[model samples]
Target: MGYKAQFHPGTSDPSKNRKKYMDPAYKLQKIRSVSDEDVVRVLGHRQPGEDYKSVHPPLEEMGEPECPIRELVEPTPGAKAGDRIRYVQFTDSVYFAPISPYQRSWMYSYRYRGMDSGTLSGRHVVEARERDVEAIAKELIESETFDAARTGIRGRTVHGHALRLDENGIMFDAMQRYVFDKSTGEVKYVKDMVGEPVPAPISVGKPLSENELKTRTTIYRADGITIKQDAEVLQMVQNVHWERSFGGFEPFKEAKF
Candidate 1:
């Protein structure tokens, strides 16, 4: 008999979305298109036509290492080429953003290979080989999981996820990295992820509508869909809390909630 993985437990939209995003088998819906050049510009790690920098010589050229673990596991394209490690960080607004930092970490862990992810209160950061990070960034920017207004690609000074939105319904960025264009009603990035000025504006496309955001949002908010409404999720939360509180002292005692 084999054990199957249940990504998350709950029937609510947020729970279902969390599970979907964490499942590599589920295809993420592409909601917008950003050019590869634009992706590079936003990432600010290198120029559009610049060659990827390498940390070491290619794996094949290095030779001489015959380890059982190395033979069992296949290296990623970037790893094989020994590309330099790079990172992409995202800040998700609390106001019904499509996806939050915690879920972003979970999704990345399941979908990505040879990478590391960290989740903070307001943001998530993923580090991988340079080219691989760019590919991951582009996919996430175009996916339904990202909303231009509520989701920010910030490498540093990620401070707006918990703040109130601006007049145009865009998240408040301390760096003012992106702006809402009144003419096209689109959100454009005038600066790179780290607040460095870019040569041209990179349009990530228009923000999703309020209704659309609510539908796709993986966050459970009191104003939208409260966590209390999902019985199974609430039970799981309580159980986790109970285990954390008493498990250290009473390893054999049953949790009562």
Candidate 2:
């Protein structure tokens, strides 16, 4: 029998959320509605309805190098069309953000291909062929993984992952790419990801309540559930650590530590 895949092992909400985020088969819940035009607007990659700029001739026209590996591997749409590489970045809050930087990398690994991702203490970046990147960014921004106030779309000058949220309960951004609307109580992007001015404001929607953020957050804290609460998770972590340490020595020898 073929082996079935297991995403992660845990009983806690955060653990379950992690599994859900890292499962490719799981269709992330769409919690907000942002049009493709608006998504493009915030990214500032290309003008709306503009033809996708290409780096080279299409793979079919150019005739790729004759290699077995090339024949076996299917290229993504953007790659086939020779689209330029583009990037999108997100900064997640430490205080009950739905997903953190490390988890975002894991989620991207499971859910995407033909892309490169990097993680930092405060932010995560995904780079891929332009069209594919735009699609991925749009989905991520509108999905439940994103919270209007907690999740930031920043291409440069990533800040506010550790600082206290503003009075409106939104993460702080030195560039002021996004701002809170007092009347509508929604978050709007007046500037592009790199702090460039957009033609007009684009509303991302209202922020989630603090209670909602806690319930959806994947981060473990003293106030919320912790790893100590799940013995299976703790044991799995310890087992992996022990095995890695043991592997450092002879394979046949028993683990002493």
Candidate 3:
């Protein structure tokens, strides 16, 4: 029999959300629309109409040795074209953000190929071929995984995930990459992800309401769904903690709750 993957363990909304986000079969809901040109501008890797710079000659053009592994493995579009590697970083607010950095790493692993992801305390960065990274950034920006208010696309100065939300309920960006538009009731990016100015403001749509955020949030909070409330998740956490703490010294002993 084929093995079935259990993405997560719990019945809570956050747990369910984590599982759903990790499952590649689940199509993430599109909550907003950001133009492809705007996506390129915000990535700050290249100009809107600029050609992708290549680190090496295209696979077909390069005189390559015939290896069995290379024959069996299919190269991604960017890889085949020998595009230079680039990255996109996202910071998720702790205050009812739909997704967190750790989960973002897991989701990216399941959903993407030919890329590497790193997770920090509050930020996640995915590195891939230049064009591939741009595609990924655009999809994630438009998907439910991103909230215009709670999620930030920051290439640097990623220090606002743990801070309190601003008066407009937007995540505090020290770079001030994005601003809340009062008249349109939307969030617009005046600068690129790395803090350079863009030609025009790129609107990423309005912020989700507090109630909507709560419903979609994958974070466990005392004010909402606490981890303590989910026995299965709590048990899993304890088991992992025990293994990491004592498994090295007491390899033969069972963990006691």
Candidate 4:
């Protein structure tokens, strides 16, 4: 589903009540603020980063727009037509919340380069702690979604809970070179040297039904620092996300996409 931006306005303090919006990127990552009056005044413009262009001034310059909503989505449960909200959707369900809507044009430009490519896809989750790759691999292995023997990104194998047949998967890999200091037993690594993994050789073949396609297909780590691959139920995996993470969107809360 497309991202729908919602504007929330306030005078006392916008930060105190930022949780109302569903678009977490603006809140968690961007930390932008919009007032209610701005939402009611600005002309309707696509939020920055959508395939369409916006004529509005940058957030820094304009402070905030008239109407808070930027992107659009269908009204969600318990939501009214005039509700100021951001909507998060996956499959057939939509969730609504109030949040500051910020432009993501720069990110979209880098991720979807083709003129025909518009709209963002995918979502990410913010974890409480950094996930250990080795632990994640162990979980995948235990779950039995991927064969432990066949799975290895840059010689580092995933051995975690396996993914379920009905669930979609996203993979990210960071390949790095390290210099081990013999005296201190410490490894120093440069952030610039990290890169993406090579594409996987095996592909998930076409399933018998649409349900199978959605259930069996998964995204896997591939070469390049930013690019990963998506494997459909019937098609071979291809390069994707040269500039973004899996699912194209960031996750709010722990809910699965």
Candidate 5:
């Protein structure tokens, strides 16, 4: 039964005539013999995925296996050395992480990755000294407190505006931005002097009138300090002081005498 060959009307039974179809001598006769004359000429070489190997440049003459990887390019002619500007990709945002001298790649610590991934030197190390810097910066910003030595000052006469104090009193050179205060003598506000277009003193040559001075000076009770000169409008300001004006317009409700 297993060997019985059956014919359905037009079809020959494959089981009974298995040799007729399966024999290599007759079935694969098309590729049985190859000769220089019968050989098909392949115009171009077939690549890796092709089936039949060409005759002209036979499979035996094929070149070596190619590498799948590529090489990295070096920096440009004048490119800066450090990898400080390298960007790293993490979950979402592309973070700019500074590559430190010690480590060539991004830090591998999980804590570092969790904080701000892809930062070469983690946020903690990079930002370690920042708080101290910010604290000092805040102190400087608040130190805009008035200087008592500058009160009742006329044009170019206030200590803060003097080029060379006549009485050796504290002063700030309108030209140099240097403050000769008792605590910190010859203190140069370098930022103000070096910043673009350089900040100028608010009231150096122009004398503040009684009403102008009264209106110009505003006391901030929260800070317990008075702003003598309007840093916004004036340049080369000669008038500045710490002494509270006796009877001026009071703005703050929590102001204490």
Candidate 6:
């Protein structure tokens, strides 16, 4: 092959983690299991076994327009079934959480289809068909990317990513959606993402060890893996910035890599 695809650049461990997460080919290691029904309950959108309410008819019923692009492309199962759009939002602590909002968007774009993502200061929200969102949420919750104490599933009032952790070692939640069980040493969610009470609390399993977080995290920090250490990544960023500046000012000049 002339040119193989490269996901991200850097020799640092965090940089390597960034590449692994963004590559669709890499299967995220599963850390725990939460039932599909439990995921539905945690979302608090529709109860388990409830029929999916739709804004438009299924594609099979109404049929798509006679466009060549539409003919060539296949719709997601949710789109074909006319499932309503739903969202799942996650808040990542700045204390070396495995993945952050920007990384989540990159990973999601690489791994999924028929979805839209919004990244903010503290949260990353992915919106897709209801069932599809549920599936994605479940996988993310049970994966190594999510530390029960660090990654929060918050649909609203997301305001604690930058704050210091509590004595219990869990990130602060304004709504107190989850609590660290002192006895079991597990993080359990008592409320839904939107701060609504769930019928029963769901356990997302134990938090990862500090060493594990340091190894798997994509964040570049002075205390951990700093960006300055990754010379390749830093140079690439500078090159891209320089190229953009030169292109904006000297449109006629041939750009250099």
Local distance difference test, each candidate: 0.93, 0.91, 0.94, 0.23, 0.23, 0.90
> Which tens-of-lDDT digit does each residue in 101-208 have in candidate 1?
999999999999999999999999999999889989999999998898999999999998888999999999999999999999999999999999999998889998
TM-score of each: 0.97, 0.93, 0.97, 0.16, 0.15, 0.94
Location of the lowest summed lDDT over 10 successive residues in candidate 4: 88-97
Worst 10 residues of 3 by lDDT: 246-255
Pick the winner on lDDT between candidates 2 and 6. Answer: 2
- Cα-lDDT of candidate 6: 0.90
Ranking by TM-score: 3, 1, 6, 2, 4, 5
TM-score of 2: 0.93
Please write out the lDDT profile of model 2 over residues 1-257, one tens digit for every residue: 99876687888888889999998989999998888998898899999999999999999999777999989999999999999999999999888999999999999999998999999999999999999999999999989999999999999999889999989999989999999999999999999999999998989899999888888988988878888898878878887998876766777766553
Tens-digit per-residue lDDT, 1-257, candidate 6: 59766799988998998888888889999989999888998888899899998878999899677999888889888888899999999999999888999999999999989999999978999999987898899999888889999899998989999999999878989999999998999999999989999988899988888898999999998899888899999888887888777757877775565
Q: Of the candidates shown, which would achieve the greatest lDDT relative to the real structure?
A: 3
The C-alpha local distance difference test score for the whole of candidate 1 amounts to: 0.93
After the best TM-score superposition of candidate 1, give how far the Cα of residue 70 lies from its true spot, in angstroms. 1.0
Candidate 3 residue runs with Cα over 4 Å from true position: none
lDDT of 4 by residue, 1-257 (tens): 99664432221122223212223453222212223222111111222233322333334454444453533432222122121222111110001111101212222222221211112222211111111211222222232122211122222222221322212222222233222334543322221111222122122111123333222223211211111221231121122332234464544533232
Which residues of candidate 1, in runs, are more than 4 Å off? 1-3
